[model samples]
Target: MSSLEIVKQYYTSFNQKNWNGMLALLHPEVRHEANQGDVRIGTGKFTEFLQKMDESYEETLTDMVFFTEPADSRVAVEFVVNGIYKKGEEGLPEAYGQTYVLPAAAFLELKEGKISRVTTYYNLPLWIELVSKPRND
Candidate 1:
């Protein structure tokens, strides 16, 4: 499969919250560089991260645009993340189902049709501020 197709399928599975489907597209030793976090290696680490996120937040990705250059194996994607903080995280403001939307970008490297590395970037302060504000409802 082409890199574009692989990436498209990955996101589609992600949107569906199909954890197995998403993990199937990744290498066993996939490298993950989560936004504002240390680089983690292996699918085990990725699964743990997903579990933690699932516990703390409910999120969806929207307005996605994927970019790739000729002769490059990397794909960069821009999207908006809309999320509700369901539980408080360490060193973060309290969570009371506060919803926030923010634009983010991710760079992915594919190896033999499987994602080997992923690095994402997003505004942490903007998210914290938005989620920290007092909710009217």
Candidate 2:
């Protein structure tokens, strides 16, 4: 499949919370960077990250637009996240199922038929502010 097709399926799998589906697109030694975290290598590390995220937050992406270069090796996606903080997380604000909307982006490097590297960007402080708001909970 094309890099763009892989990326589109990646987000579709993500929105479905399909851990296996998301992982299916990764190269065995895939490298990943989440938000501003240090780079992590391998599909195992990526799996752990996804598990942690699932435990703390529930989110869906909306208004997604993708960009690909002529070389067909890289793809970038821009989207907005509609999410709820389901539990308090370390080094972050209180959760209590706080609702938030935030913009995020990701860049992917495709190798062979799988994703070799994945990097994502988002405004952490803005997300904190949104979830920090006094919730009726």
| Candidate 2 lDDT score relative to the true structure | 0.93
Tens-place lDDT digits, model 1, residues 11-83: 8988888888888999999999998778999999999988888899888999999999785688999999989
Pairs that collide in candidate 2 are none
Q: Backbone clashes per model, in order?
A: 0, 0
TM-scores for the candidates: 0.95, 0.96
Regions more than 4 Å wrong, model 2: none
Candidate 1: which pairs clash? Answer: none
lDDT of each: 0.90, 0.93
**Candidate 2: tens digits of C-alpha lDDT, residues 21-116:** 999999999999888768899999999889889999999999999999999999999999999899887789988988889999999999998999
Least accurate 10 contiguous residues by lDDT in model 1: 67-76
How does residue 84 of candidate 2 score in lDDT?
86
Q: Best lDDT goes to which candidate?
A: 2
